[model samples]
Target: MTMTVVPAPAETGHSVAPPGRNRRVRQHWGATPYLFLLPALTLLGVFFVWPAVTAVQLAFYDYRVVSPAEFVGLGNFSHMLGDDRFYTALTNSGLFLIGMLPILVVIPLLLAVLVNLPLRGIKVFRLVYYLPVVTSMVAVAIAWNYVYHQRGILNWLLNTLGLLDQPVQYLLDPGWALPALVLVESWKSLGYYMMIYLAGLQSVPRELYEAAAVDGAGPWRRLSSITVPMLRPYIAVVMVLAALDSMQVFTSVFVMTQGGPQDGTLTLGYYIYDAAFRHFNMGYASAMGLVLWAILVVFSLVSYRLTRGKAAAR
Candidate 1:
């Protein structure tokens, strides 16, 4: 052996397989993705899944924070249906959603299109439009609170313009409270939705627009024939987002009106907060939250189905 000593394979740059053999390696690499996903999956299970399950379970029981949780079995649902306040909140939520949907959806699309136009300083315009989106909701609510005040800048501006005979109680009057809140919510959300639409618009092929132009189609016609059809997914996304945001509207009502003036601005979201924190009915509040979640799920499913059906029809 000493007379015929040979170098070990480690010292030489030789391997068992041929060069570039890495390309022949199995690309699937099964189980690696799942292994990497384990931490996130465990966190989701512990944080979201378990809590949601417990909330649903507690919903069937009549358990206040201070009282024993007694199994009620749909009693909360029955009570909800029978309660006038619940009905009022539901109605207000419906009205708010209806009033805000068009503004939330249409305004953003228009803004996105406008900013996407081949014009100078469009980036500046985009920044201006997106400013509201990044602003804090609490700050937005507070600013709007002052604006809607009877003796605030809004009234002053109206007075300056001679638009009204006197100051209006925007948040105090039942007739105006919901609508006022809706407007503020739409304004705050418009920038975010507009950004989403902008991204979608950017993804749309410019060749289609050029082709439409070659075919002697005008801007509106091109939009109808090409832009709208291609943007169905984004539209669906906006609708669902607007609906969810509208359903979960709370901060504006809390800060601006506190769901006051005969509970005119009381939404389901506000009701949950009121029940849970204000009244200290934690168990009942959890039940209400579960019910709210069910309602939201139904609304979401219906909206999704309707939007998808329309898209499919085309």
Candidate 2:
């Protein structure tokens, strides 16, 4: 007997999805993240983007808060070339960068290595080191003011050690003002850089140290060969950060010296503030700000290239 054969349903060129599948996919994959990000994006635009654009526009226009903005094109920037104080501020900023680099970049690594040792109550030491980083800068500056005072503990210790003939006014002396501020800034931020190095150290393999030790490598040799090379990226990051901090040093200068003692501590940041607020030369200040920003950008680019090239060579 011949069985009656039924043809199965033919497949279509386009397949139909389930009724709610597309809706579910769309709901799960889209819009939610953007919706959650809306607040942050709005805040950033309002606070950062808007202010940056205003600053750039104001760089070309003379605005003294009381007077109408007068467009002068590159006049503000041109004026900077003839301004002696601008050059002085630039020079001081460079000094800060030079002084802070070793303090933040090199010394912090050693500090991190010291704190990273598996010793009892080491966390307490780490916490103490990081305390200044978390403390308010204003408070730190006030505390440092006492430390730098003519009759303060620092001077007393120096006198006791016969390092000085008499107490010196650190903040009031032109020769010492910038260096004093640099030390304060460096000390306050040392903990931060230390934490960064500590984090980098955590990822390094203990086996490398073991192997190096097995090969008769001493601590300094291992540090120079393994730790330094491994921490290159961290060093690059710290360098860029420290450079930026040094270049834009304002609060310490303002609080401690007020750019006094013959303007020895007049950093670019403080100069911008002085021009804008004290002298009411907002346009010139904005121009200087732009120049400072350009300098920082250049420094970052150079640092990145050097670090990346070294990394690639290795």
- How many steric overlaps are in each model, in order? 0, 0
TM-score of each: 0.84, 0.90
Candidate 1: stretches off by over 4 Å: 1-38, 214-216, 303-314
RMSD of 2: 3.9
Candidate 2: misplaced stretches above 4 Å?
Answer: 1-29, 306-314
Residue-wise C-alpha lDDT for candidate 2, range 130-237, written one tens digit per residue: 999999888899999999999999999999999999999999999998999999999999999999999999999999999999999999999999999899888888
Query: Judged by TM-score, which candidate is best?
Result: 2
- Distance (Å) between predicted and true CA of 52, model 2? 0.5
Output the number of the lDDT-best candidate. 2
Worst 10 residues of 1 by lDDT: 19-28
RMSD of each: 5.4, 3.9
Please give the distance, in angstroms, between residue 93's alpha carbon in candidate 2 and its true position after superposition: 0.1
In candidate 2, which residue pairs get closer than 3 Å at backbone N, Cα or C atoms, i.e. clash?
Answer: none
Residue 296 CA displacement from its true place in model 2, Å: 1.4
- lDDT tens digits by residue: candidate 1, 196-304: 8989999898999999999999988987898888888888888888888888888888888888889999998899889878887666677778877887898789778
